[model samples]
Target: MLKKLGQFTLSILVVSLYSNITSFANNKPLTEAEFKATKLPYSVMAYSNKYAHEYGLDASKAIKLPKGLEAIKLTLSKSFSKGYGPYASKWDYNCTAELYVDKSLNLYWPGDHAKVDKVDDRGLQKSQISTAQLEKKGKYWVPGPYASMLYDAYDKTVKADLASVKLSFFGCGYIPSRYTAAKDGLAIWLEKKGGYNYAVIGQGEREISSKDFYVFKLPQNLVNSYLPYARMAAN
Candidate 1:
């Protein structure tokens, strides 16, 4: 009986250790003092201080987004830049701050060179697509699950169309790839049927094909059908 009790206690300890490791992997909070001790990007620290005072080092809680970014639902993670490069950044760019928008996106803001100029060499001073543009199109921000579903469909496609056509499939798959501020969702494909190149929208029961792709638009209700998939993908 005593050996069984010891085994049970050991099992509990293992479970507790696993939980703590998982929490850390998910960006659990650090103590305020521990957070302040690290070298952080000026813009991230300043912005957090200004707008999200309650979220200092505690990323598990939701951080309130500013007005321009309110249209989309995104979880923001506050962390210093890993570095600058094609796949990842170099250590010299460590002064840069990054906002991890869940697992799908990373929004970066320029750091104040005057503040951390000594270590801040390349802080991505010029972005091709600025945050202002993102804000302007925030209504189209695909929720996590939807994004994952789209990615999965594209990843696991048994057949694909021309690159210029903007579509892929697995025997008539209905994965939604894009949504618009106009309250429309779209997935497009191109195929030669009856010796005519036809552009197709949607698949299976709710399918449409036409020469002019612009004419094919999904209604709000149909577009909303993917929300469950999107929600599921996010979790």
Candidate 2:
């Protein structure tokens, strides 16, 4: 009787532990209110990073963003906003401007979906942003020819069930090349049945092939600096 009672107690403890682990695994992304409380700038940047991870797009490179830049949600006239981009349908999806405080501004109208809980207020105040002022000071990183080629190869060749993939940023590095742009490498994680698999892109030589993928380690800061251009290439 005593042995059976002890086994029952151990089983109950194991079940309770498993339940707690499951709850943490499924915790929802931060809510809009929760994100706002942090008072951090760059909602779009945050969202893009999250998006990159979700779809296994590499955004591991460090970015040297413009100083004093911040994201502001604004309501613009329907006529002007219509010509902007696809991020907005009606005016309810206000434009999130990546503004370089009193300098340049680039606008993005993200959909009414929760990404990393970085929400934009629908009731955003009307815009003083003139159409002419939109891209005046705006500047963005551009990928070099080699990076662009790699991006094309990845986009055209890579395929996966994005929903099932887990984000993996194992860092990346670059080495100077005599012929092309710097040699680059990165590792990505993809989830498969019952477990995860490691895939890597060895030096930016030929187009990336699945067989050549293997893990490479380099400074994370190096990866971060290069990611802005990589993200641009992917886009």
* Residues 1-235, model 1: lDDT tens digits: 3222111101000111211111222223345554344332211111122222222222232233332121111111133456546657422211111111121222221232212213232221111111111211232321211211100111111112101111112111223332223133332211122322211233222222222111112222222332222222222
Q: In candidate 2, what are the lDDT values of residues 1-235, reduced to their tens digit?
A: 3222111101000111211111112223334444334321211121123323433433452232222211111111112245346565432111122111211112112232212223233211111111111111223211122111011000111113111101111111121111232233222211112221122234324332222121112222322323332232222
Candidate 1 has an lDDT of 0.21
Candidate 1 error regions (>4 Å)? 1-182, 187-192, 195-216
Q: Please, what is the whole-model Cα lDDT of each candidate in the order they appear?
A: 0.21, 0.21
> TM-score for every candidate vs. truth?
0.17, 0.15
- Candidate 2 is scored at a TM of 0.15
Worst window of 10 by summed lDDT in candidate 2: 148-157
The pairs that clash in candidate 1 are 83-89, 83-90, 84-89, 84-90, 85-89, 145-230, 145-234, 146-230
